[model samples]
Target: MAKFKIDINANKHFTGELSPVFSVAEARKASQFHKGLQGYEPTPLRDLSSLAEMMGVKGILVKDESYRFGLNAFKMLGGVYAIARLLCEEFGWGIEQFDFDKLKNEVDEKMTFATTTDGNHGRGVAWAAEQLGQNAIVYMPKGAAEQRVKNIRSHGAECIVTDMNYDDTVRMVAEKAQQNDWKIVQDTAWEGYTDIPTWIMQGYSTMAVEAIEQIAEQGLPKPTHVVLQAGVGAMAAGVLGYLAEELGASDLKAIIVEPDQADCIYRSGSSEKGEMINVGGDMATIAVGLACGEPNPLSWDVLRNCSSHFVSVEDKVPALGMRVLGNPLAGDERIVSGESGAIGTGLLAAVHFSDNKAELMQSLNLNEDSVVLLLSTEGETDPVNYRDVVWQGKYSSI
Candidate 1:
């Protein structure tokens, strides 16, 4: 088994200030726009009380994203919101003037939206393009799950399976988008590509907005800590950025987790907490969505500024987490968390049940008085692999 690893970020840049892109204001703005979308309902925020009890925490809250816009994933929030914002800017239509139907009517010619994804983000881009009466072409990294590709194609978008790894595939799509005059709605930002990705990051903060509101509804205290799973750190930036802005950065602790093979964020933070470092090659892990080798430069800044610690774990760890959520303990709601979605939970479970619980607990500042929030970002995006892990016991903890 690959050993679990942790990195504490030195020289954090959080000074109770919010970046313009992933700020709380942007999240609320995105949330308002999202509310105007058809079939928009906030996904359930489930309290894993039994699991919290088992782990000796005061409260454990999980935002279940499987039901998001009926997409079985939360990525569409970023994808759709970014598209809407892009269109609004392109046509001088205000956000209030940018409802789906109204925007579809305003489109004179079909714009092609293009992006690369391991799975969820591509589907989101494709779905948004389809909804806007435009065209979409999604590119996937080598050996991406067929199910994820199929999901994107179902949105009437062209799906391209590349022979390259994720980061390289991203470059491929960038070239393709430029060649075809397509709008690249990539969630990760590189140089000269900050605005759209920034909007996408803001879109993700909708979950954080709802989670905080839901916590208040339940009369639970604000989350003392947040456990975020990173893939290019887009989702991590969105959620953490908003949280740090809402709750004082110094008040909330952030933990970032990733598959050991693709833990670019972890590696970047660990190396004297310097410039963003990247891992390359096929990150052959079951958590395919989290198999991104490059840290998004936009989110890398947010993560380095806000995150307290980074943890990297083996594939078996999230498989263990899938089992834990799949098989509910007592009255806790069974959340069919996919490999990428459940890694945070898996890491928690591994630490709680391990011989190093004391050390791990202290390192994470996880204690009986702490209220923790975890994001189950996607459901079974690839049902076959999910069944293999949860049913066939592939990558079992034993």
Candidate 2:
């Protein structure tokens, strides 16, 4: 079991901001990368009018990622892209050279790739490893739910359970990287090793770009507000980066949400520095993804400066949002979202903190027309917990 320590001093070194929004050239590159990715498609951007009415909102849009690459989550784009990019860089091989069959044939079962994840990210890395025929060693915090762990191992990755929380598992992976000749491809960046993580963030831009096109095709209002739930903030950073670059002066506000107990981004924004807060105990929910003690070193600066607001929501919000999306009112959509995945919709309901309800209705202008966008970033990564909360009304208390 790995021990997680709050490194007050280490957090200080992460005080720099994100790179500017993608340049036209960079945007084009990201788009091309998105296009090159195999079996990748934009998840639907659907309106959940019934839920919106229940929340006293004019309109609610859900960017459902449950269908992303048949992986049931958005993490696959980042982790798999990072691995593909790293492999290409090391071998001087074009990414196009990586046919699934060829990559699968190359594995000798001797080399291992290491990453630390709470849930979706690990499943993503494991899925990538299985596709590429590489062995993967995943380090996860001890309290990770069985369903999430099973998902990772089911992808043929070896899972290591640690005694600490998500932050410590990161350190555990770092140590493993040093002791073993394993390639470390992680979504969150640390000092000096920021490139691959940055690539992972860039890969996430594909989703945002897809969302823009999808919204346009649907003839809906442009997204006025984007609610992102952060762990280390990489996912939020990725989406925001693309939106800033492609969406063009759309009066978009990026609202960030985190667990009340694990509110590192909120505190970091308030503290005006990259901050670390030790979670009091085991995580209270199996959103399993957003329970982090600190924001990623590379992402905190970007999140603090670029995001419109950082709000902390109770864990129950996600469970409620998940139920709402799956409810009969939502129709046959089958939006199998998990806790963290529902945070965006949770923020939509808790509009006082968001301060966007008026803007949502376009009441300030009396247009009575506006659009709100929420990202359902994962599917039911923890089906047991999902069933317990949504069906049985019995959620595990932390």
Candidate 3:
């Protein structure tokens, strides 16, 4: 039998009916309302000319989100924006009154926020709550990393470990919020609670908006292929919305990558419906951000229309990504990365392999003239994985 886990699959799944709900102009307006958000930061898009040349591309760039609000991950953008929007929408205040820094400094400590996470999103929600001088309760699965649990606790949030996985944790958190009237802010969407998650997705549009501006300034052509790793599709929705509004569907070919174990989008494309799968075991890839099942319905709608393709990357790709990018940058230059944050570049490598290059390139249909963009959504948050991938160079060893 073919090594199913090692084999790469080329699957093109698209839904012809879904339409864009938010435009770039609308996203821009939301971004303006978030002008002084505490965790907002201008992430850098660094040129990888040398790496691009090595991969036979004209240009390759990495949108480094390592320094986003000093949180070391892009999850904060969505979480913070979602929470801020929820607060504003709930309180009927203008953006000026919801100014995060000002509100954070003055808000009563009696307030509370709640969210469910595999790790990063909960940490982000907890961090945002702490910064805003509010109480936070973070729910996680039973097997969540000690580091993430500790990180949430460090931010003064109560970390409740449930006897379930990430998806179950989400349900538990929702139930708790319903019973207790806690402010539940999640980046993923469900029925009746799409607004906050949509706002969170809108917050992620800042990355795409920034990418377009940075490409213009760097003298690089527009990206021909933009690959993103997704869990619930919030991040991908943000980028797709930007591309649909600014570049149009024909200008940019987009792909959503996920681990073979948690390929909800891949399966959704194949089946033409949203499906939920149980998540458990051996999710050792550092790119843990995308390890989610049960696609976000709104995001699923957008990705179905806007994204051109979906690919399932192996767990090993993340290890390789960390080894490749983390070695020279982290070991020699002191650059650090979290496992879940580095998978964008890993997707880039998987899509550019020599054996599959012919079909992959044909699917994407680009030559040396093509420009590519990858989002590095976080720096190393787990010190142990950081040291192993960066200093030890243990990607293949895994």
| RMSD, every candidate, angstroms | 1.8, 6.5, 3.5
State model 2's lDDT.
0.70
The C-alpha local distance difference test score for the whole of candidate 3 amounts to: 0.71
Which digits, one per residue and each the tens of the lDDT, describe model 3 over residues 1-398? 01113333333444433244557775776666555664456788877777677667887777887777777777777777777777776668764457666666655545678888877788888887876777899887666778878988988999988887667778888998989988888877877988888878887887878888889997888888787878878888876877776876756777777777777777776653444333455444446677677688878778877777777767766665665566543212323556766666665565555456766667666578878888877777777767776677655533
Question: Pairs clashing in candidate 1?
Answer: none
TM-scores for candidates 1 onward, in order: 0.96, 0.84, 0.88
- The reply for model 1, stretches above 4 Å from the true place, is 1-17
Q: Residue 186 of candidate 2: its Cα lDDT?
A: 84
Question: What residue runs in model 3 are displaced by over 4 Å at the alpha carbon?
Answer: 1-20, 38-40, 101-109, 272-286, 328-335, 351-354, 393-398
lDDT of 2 by residue, 77-119 (tens): 8887778778777657786555556556664454578998888
Cα lDDT over the full model 1: 0.87
After superposition, the stretches of candidate 2 with alpha carbons farther than 4 Å from their true spots are: 1-18, 21-31, 53-58, 96-110, 272-281, 328-334, 352-369, 395-398
Minimal lDDT window, size 10, model 2: 1-10
TM-score-best of 1 and 3: 1
Q: Assess the local accuracy of residue 51 in candidate 3 as a C-alpha lDDT between 0 and 100.
A: 65
Candidate 1 versus truth, CA RMSD in Å, comes to: 1.8
Give the clash count for model 2: 0
Top TM-score hit: 1
